[model samples]
Target: MEDLLGSYIIFLILLFVETKGIPPVTLAIIILNMFIFLSPALGVGEVCLSVSTTLYGCEWQRLALAPLHHIDLDHLGFNMASLVWKGSRLERRIGSARFTFSICSFGLLTGLTYLLIKATLSFLLSDRFNLDCAVGFSGILFALKVINNGHSCDGNIPGPFHIKKRDACWAELVLIHLLSPRSSFVGHLAGILVGLAYVMGPLRMMINWITGKETSSVRFAECCQLSRNGHPDRDSDGDCQSTCLPRHRRQRRRC
Candidate 1:
């Protein structure tokens, strides 16, 4: 860890590795993450450890920037590679619109989860985990993996261990924490919970109903027109055909 540049060499090599058929939103996230990593800010901001700065006030930006910032080049490279692999399956399965919504929603949701867990521990065990500042996309990556695993019928990660798909996220969570002892365990665990929330909890239904202005632009299986007055009108060839339906129901919008 002391040799940050040395750790970056492997990441540089991975830069040339080609991954085909990356979905558009996935690619955009990768580019945005990489750009932020290389920018003058280097993903540094009032985030990272801002969750529980003190009892009086919180930076709030941590909820937004933490997922996008990385501590090092190696971290950025590894996360981007994982996104390419995971996003290929997730974004393609659910359509870029829903996947995009999930990513944004999951990021904020996981941060709140992280804070709650930290606060709980701080109260009970005096762990003071909430004051801990952390950054990176790995937490959300874990969340995505949980959802991806849900879509698998056979539902097991194919490997020497034959880990059951249901438990794979927990296994990886432990493995990642062990390997990188410096990483925040609470942040990662929060992501796993968020994924579970999305899979079996109220998250999916909530996302389905909360109509953002961007909802009209999403690709549903069939385009439903929103009348100019802002209600769903009868199906017509009007350009207003738009937005998402429930999970596993919507197909890519042709219009």
Candidate 2:
């Protein structure tokens, strides 16, 4: 997790450099140092400790204020750098601001959901077992994979041996079979659901709302008919009149 955080920090720095006049090559070097070298040196234990202390310890405020400064490089390691790199590339293609927001939101939501479920299970089975100390990028990674593969509805990539239609469904089934007995799978499932909801719900709404600024969902022919009858085409014209006005004006007298 610390490694992931380090990568995020490096990406942010690269963004800053791009905004300025700094060379992109320099940013690449920084990325290599932070992700490839520093991360493995730090390992997983330090990363978990950092998260626990920053989010729940007495010095939470200070740690939260400057988490990058406090990350322990000596206790972090990479698990699947290649997969993360691919996911990061996909995220860049999706647009950095949107990707960043979605990733962070999914991570937080998945973590909270896992914590709640574990807590509930522990209560229900009192003294039988204890659930504590969970950490991994599996959830966020799964979420990114889902988003990159074009959401749950799009299904999986079809190949000679791949399943068709409900591709995502099959991939998920395989994932469950592979990871079922592990605690991390719970978080992974939560993240997948969060990713699907985000893409199909809020993110879809936001993108449509933004792009539909000068148009309505109503068909153009319907708009013309309503407008010609002297009644406001409230569904379309009212919102899109400006977009259509120049063409309309060019065909008629201005008087």
Candidate 3:
């Protein structure tokens, strides 16, 4: 019990410090999730993502707020840790505007995915559908994890069984599901689908429109490289125009 308490204490301290230099949207998301989880007395749980309530009763707002609530300390801590690790890097790579847009799009879709599945199951199995009252930011974490792994070049992710970088997201999905019983499997699976949709489907086009940045192919590389050189701003044409660039070389070459 003492160890558990200590873990929570440490998590709180780390969360406080982790916001430093984090992309604005990412930091705000972490703060919002933490605040809502710690303030359950405010009746945040009623807005939790519920398939039955959302679909049958038409409480659509729950889909937006549900990911911000958590079942317990462990669930919250695990999801937050993953968010900090993957979200911070992805936000830096894609820029805050695109990152925020992606999070909103992905979060809603994940809830909708769960809703679709539950509705189908209900129809197929009448009285036997288990309406899992899912909550927490795991779905977004999973979505961000998929995006991060796709853009990362840090080689393989180290673990009990070493896995290649490209395959790490799937490995994590499987492993975390096996370890975290409280986590919603369908929600995380939906997050994966959303990530893939963004990468391969029309969602990518929407993100590009939202941020005015090309998110498809070369933009990830350009964003990471330019940010590394301390140039977060891009030109109207979506090319790096950092003040750090030489006057003659600003448009033609890297800083």
Over 4 Å off, model 2: 1-79, 82-86, 126-130, 151-183, 203-255
* Model 1: pairs clashing at backbone N, Cα or C within 3 Å: 49-133, 221-251
Candidate 1 has its poorest 10 consecutive residues by lDDT at 235-244
Candidate number with greatest TM-score: 3
lDDT of each: 0.70, 0.44, 0.69
In candidate 2, which residue pairs get closer than 3 Å at backbone N, Cα or C atoms, i.e. clash? Answer: 42-73, 42-74, 42-75, 42-76, 43-75, 43-76, 43-77, 156-167
Candidate order by lDDT, highest to lowest?
1, 3, 2
Q: What is the overall TM-score of model 2 with all chains considered together?
A: 0.47
lDDT of 1 by residue, 165-219 (tens): 7689889888988998988888889999998887784786787776332242232
**Per-model tally of clashing residue pairs:** 2, 8, 0
Model 3 residue pairs with clashes: none
User: lDDT tens string, model 3, 87-113?
Assistant: 877776667777787889889988898
Off by over 4 Å in 3: 1-20, 41-45, 159-162, 215-255
| Per-residue accuracy of model 2 over 1-255 as CA lDDT, tens digit each | 666776766755565554442233223423554554444544333433122343345333321122122223322223234234434444444444445454555656666665555556656876322324445555666666555444222222556566643246336646565864543455566667765664556744664465442221222222232246655433221222333444444543320
